[model samples]
Target chain A: MFFFKLPFLNLLRHYGRTSLSLVSIILGVLVIILGRGTITGLRESVIRGEIDGMTGHVSVLPADYPTSGLLHPLDGLYSLPPAAEQWLHANAVAWTRRLFFAPRLVSGIDAIRVRAIAFDPATDADVFPRRDWRVEGRIPETAGDGVLLSRGIARTLSVQPGDMVVLETRTVAGAMNALQMPVAGIVSTGNPAIDSIILFLPLSAGEDLLRTDGAISHVSLLLGRRTDADAAAQQLQELLGEAVQTTTWEKEAAPGLEAQDLRQRFLDILVVALLVMAAAGIANTVLMAAYERIREVGTLRAMGLTRRGVAGLFMAEGFVMGLIGSLIGAMLGAWLTFKYSIEGIDMTALVEEMGSGEMFQDIPFSSMLYFGFSGRTILLAIAVGMIVATISSLYPAMIAARKEPADAVRS
Target chain B: MKICEVESVCKIYGRGAAEVRALDDVSLVFEPGEFTVISGPSGSGKTTLLNMVGCLDTPTSGRVVLEGKDVSTLGERALAHVRAKRIGFIFQSFNLVPVLSALENVETALHLARFSGNRRKTAAEMLDAVGLRDQMRRRPTQLSGGQQQRIAVARALVKHPGLVIADEPTANLDSKTGTQILDVMRQMNESFGVTFLFSTHDPRVMERARRIVSLHDGRIAEDRTREKPSAAGEVALTSDASNESNA
Candidate 1:
């Protein structure tokens, strides 16, 4: 009790020095919180946008198809047997069939190379709903010479809904054929690559035009629960054997996965650099405070304080500094997040070079970017602050403890 | 009975040609309630002898017996325990912590001695006894040199230790203030039966002491007892008489 009062009063007496040290600590803590929060928010936003924009949780592709490597000539479409389809129906919650191929699209005087996707209207509607796609007209329901053109493609061809367009592609026998189909709708998917080059048609019409019978390029699935995606993919692979292949959304979207990995590595490097700088600032501030209080420490020792007691006193000071700094940093970080959450920071003018197309569209700094205060983040911040403070005080506290009573008196 | 007994205590500085013996073959006895002064020139080992008796420093050789316990054989922690409970010290510079009020400074000794219950009141009583009742709430820097020394004296006596070791207790004060401080010590000695041992070179301090031990060249030169002198000739008689008697 007697020992506790002395250090508290000492800190009060030297309020100027104490406040200076606290400010340095607060700046360090604020940097840590803001840096980590921004990086985490960015990663989460990118992942969520990617998942919702195109890829579902899991996808099923042909076993012979090398999805991750350079595209070689495809070895025809493979079909899932009745038993496999039954397993999918029983175990999977949502599934769709996609027939994708690169071909030449022609409308009037405009002719452009494009990628075409054929899917079942009923099943694909549950996953990538036609309502969410920006459309100039209604999507085609029956599969008879009907097609959907992307907004960019519609502009290039000077075509609108009810206009006729031609698609040219090689049939399974390697003969090129052209088929004229009516434009049922023009879609704007907001992604530049998808907006400019993608066309969608019904499965039966795509099969007839390509001269294939009941064969699909791949099947995409969305499990009832995301966590079950990986396990379902594995089970589908084992059940389908070597002739068939199964791929999950994470694997099929290799570019997105690689981007996420690169982002995490960059964030790790940045966090380490910030922590080192913070520790240095804290150490320097604490060292100065400790030296200034040499006489005070000596007096406490003379007043029957043990060496442990002396160390505890300085440790208390460090702890208080860290705690106050962390609290201030949390408040500052939360305020920044809240302020930006309501009024998003627009990057459209800044990123004008990336084009104004919907695909290369500006991502508003929305409330989605606002970080929620989880218990984990708070605990981690406190632990980091305290650990840094304690480590910085070790050298200074040791110096305080080793002082000689007589020499201190003389000084 | 002797409360403190130092026998053949020696404290040396360096090795061989650079050697300096701060206290060489110094032996002394301090009785229970006597006000004794150890006087000497600057490097004559008076402070060294006082440190050994106060259990603040251990001798290089020989023993310091306090109340029949040989302190030289004890470990560092045990020596600290002895210092806390059995001995009190008043430094020449009035080594009170600058952050603490005068009352808190005095209460420190009692706290270390584990004396509980009404500690502030007891500390106030001690400060009043030393004639600094009004200055109890002021810090050491706020008080005068004489007032700070009086607080030190109060700190030394508040724990009611068997012995109080004061090193140059009047070194930083004026003659009149020093005398007033000494009068408080004399009163505490008479009223509370607290033994006082001072290491000083001041003639006024020596005159007030009932027993005087003089040191020279790190060794005791003379030890004598003085029958209490009247106030008028006390300083002159103690100085002149000690010189003639020793010569």
Candidate 2:
């Protein structure tokens, strides 16, 4: 015997107001979905760049080393302790050692002080993206006297592969040392910092130039997943004891994450503001409807509709309005995401045009970026819309409920 | 037994220099099955009296007893409960919900009254009683004024309320339609034995009422009763003492 019917007719009575509310909610949901999708895309790209083409999941350093930055003094070098070496072999998917120094690269009159990094070229390819580096002559072998230079450095020297170059740096004993080796290949990492001043060579060539036997700078461990970096770092610290220090990719990428965090906070504030505007708009419309139908409300009350019953009707109306608007919004958001996902945003050109900034140093800064989004984003938008609408309806519904039936219909 | 008792109730309006007594200590009792009208000129308090009797307003002084409960003694919630179970209303403007069809308008009352039955079937029957079965699916806007008022009457009587209050129920309709709608109300009263309290400025409505209470200056100026209400209204009043002589 239920006779209280749909309140949709009331909404239909005011087409302009209803459409306005719907459009507001649609835009709000679109903003939320797009913001979330862009952030997710950025995060994924950064993690892939850092773990695969640059820093491994975790890096090990000497406990006595107080700070982390480029070019630690040559006197502060430490070897991989036997126990930590064993731990790396047992737990890590791949591991590599680096012997690095800031050296003045010289080829005739053209010279620049560049960060020289030596690697075990045999296992180095397992932890970094070098298999795709274009080769003019040949890649460096474990026993070869060949060296790799970035495109920027080669341009600075006006040299190419098969050309001879001299690397000059001071040793641990304050002795100046130099080595002349043929350039093996010129690689483009698509990252400005790595491309500008990086030099790669065989691990033996670096040890020979430094005049140290079995003395390496640090060990880097590549885990199967980026998310495992923190846990692996913690475990390595315990295994290596107090004499060694461990750091994760997150600590290294703090600056970039901090910028991302600010963007996220700004988006949160924007979402709240949008919801408030939507609430105000809907509240105004419902209030007007209540006022316009005062006499009808009075008639219903006299015929026995309770105050609670009246309030319930308005609440249902609000819920339905939000449900419809958000649903359409979700669909629109999905369509937009699909469009951009197929045709990625040109981020490499964008980053290049803007020059290099301090933000997102860990990210590879590739040529194209596709959004990462799921159905969850759409569902969250709908849920947020419904909650906002229901809350907005409260005050107006209460006013309608508390109206005096006797005076409402008079005159 | 008395269906409604207005015990010396007073309703005042305005203040000081503009103070006016809308109703001043007026008392009246209505029996079951009585088709009564509170008649007066504009500002004569006929509507105010109807409001007091219907429990839509609280009297400034004294009390209104509906069925067995004193409305003044009840809280807003409890009074609403009484209104839900015992009262129904019709308006001069034919205040039907424009969004709803004629059947739905009648069903709304049954729903609110918590009538535990097939609401649609009962509402359809109620509309049929007012000769609106064919227009049961029409919204108020789609129906003629007479048809809408007939739907209003059906809505008021659908729940079989103890008292049906109508304020100027016929003022908006033409002479013919107003009489026809009144005839529907009169028939419902005689057949169901339910009480009806209506206010009107129309003499045609008064002619059909079994009891006429005239208000002037917030007071009961005249109270008249007819032994048997006539369906022919003014025609019976004019032709009359012998309209019964033929019988």
Candidate 3:
């Protein structure tokens, strides 16, 4: 107890200097918590966008379809085999048929290029409900020319829920086709890229406009358990043979996810840089303290304190400072993350103002971002802080301990 | 039995052209309950001899025996143990650990000695004995020089060491404060039967000591015992006669 008390009291002798070291430690730990949380939140957001807005847990596409193109391929439309359809009905939690293609919109004297997605009105909601979107009007239903237009696309075409427009596109059989449709709704999906150039229509309308007779571009399945997607995809591929290709959402989103992982690695390096800077500050402070207290070291030595005891005293000072700063930093970081997770950080205006919406087309970044907090991260930050502080202080502590009692007294 | 013995101790510093002999073939012995003052001019080796005897240092070539054990060649760790358990120290600046209160300063000595008893009570009692019972909680900066030295004396006596080495303990005090500090140390030495060794240029301290050893260069110029100055402040050094007086 005296050992601890002595070092604590010694540190108080120069409270200003001690507080400087403490502030550095706190800053380093804060960066660690907040940086890691931001990266984790980003990864979660991308996964949610893929599973909910684009791909279901498992998807079956035509064998020749290319996933890397900017526009969806309409040349490989296929009718599902009876055996594959039977297996999906028995093994899947829910399933839906969808068609994707690029179309040019003609409104007034303007013609704009955009992507269109067609959904089966009845089963699409069960398999992949886009609960994240906020729509001004109702979704398109069966047997009509009504369509849902993204807010950006509607603004570009100067159309509203009751407005009429013409969509011109190429059929799977390589024939040019055009259709007149009435807008049913304007949807804001929060992702600027999707809102800027997307339109949703009924599958029946899509088939009539494109001249496909009961054929779809793909079938997306929602599994009973998301973790069972890989196995189910394999089973579907075997049942369907070579006519269709089965894949999981993870495989389809790998490129974007890989980019996110690279960013995470950079964040990790920044965390280490911050911690090292803080540790350097601690080392400097401890070394300065040792130099200023040479007389005190002599006095303690003459009082019968051993060299090891002297070293331990300095290390204790570092330990106490590190512990206090790390605890406060971690708690404050957790609190901030929790608050932001609930309230969310809105970057919609920023993204729109920057006009970088197209950059998010492939990665699918939503404007509202939330942070992640974990107890394990907090504990690890604290441990790293203490270990860094103690190790940094070792050289200064040894320097103080090695002083000769008589020489130090005379000095 | 001798409380401490320095046998032909020699301390050398540097080498060749820069060689300096701090203490050369100096021999001395102290007995229990002796109050001795070692006085000399500047750089006369008074501190070096005191350090050797106090276990604060070791001579380049010599033997230092304390309480029937040779400690001259002991390692730093072992020497620290000898100092902690059986010796005490006082310095010119009081060296009271400015962060600690007067009582806590005394408690540190007991802590180093590994005293397992009630440390606070023992430290407080020592302060009380030194006539600072009301100032136990005041830090060193809060106390006067004389009071700080009294705290130092209390600290040195708290462990009940067999010998207390004071290196110019009164150098930083005024005449009045220095005399008061010397009076407190003398009382402790007499009451506890502990040997007191000091290095100083203060005439008042030398007047109060029963033995005076004067050093010149690195050798002792004189070793004599005398009765403490009388109330009239008169002292006559009488060679071996003071030994008979002690008998």
C-alpha lDDT of all candidate models, in order: 0.72, 0.78, 0.84
In candidate 3 chain A, where is summed lDDT lowest over 10 consecutive residues? Answer: A356-365
True-contact fraction per candidate equals 0.29, 0.69, 0.69
In model 3, the runs with Cα more than 4 Å from the true position are A79-94, A126-129, A222-228, B227-247
TM-score of each: 0.79, 0.86, 0.92
Write candidate 3's Cα lDDT for B102-130 as tens digits: 98899999999999999999999999999
Docking class of 3: medium
Q: Write the per-residue lDDT of candidate 3 for residues A64-172, one digit (tens) a residue.
A: 7776435677767888878878998899989999998888988778888888888899999887766668898878896474889998888877888878888999887
In candidate 1, what are the lDDT values of residues B72-103, reduced to their tens digit?
Answer: 88865576677777777887878787889999
- Could you give the candidate ranking by DockQ, starting with the highest? 3, 2, 1
What lDDT tens digits, residue by residue, belong to model 2 across residues A1-411? 232245787788888999998888888888888877776666655555555555678988767654433455667677777887888898889999887777888998889877777888778777776533555556677536578887668877888898999989887788999988889888766555565567788989888888757677667878887789999999988987777788877776665566667888888899889988988887887788888888887888787677887787787677777888788888888888777767767565566566532333324434345676778987999899887886788788898888888877662
The DockQ leader among the candidates is 3
- Clash list (residue pairs), candidate 3: none
lDDT of 1 at B101: 93
Supply candidate 1's per-residue lDDT for A401. 68
Q: Candidate 1, which CAPRI tier? A: acceptable
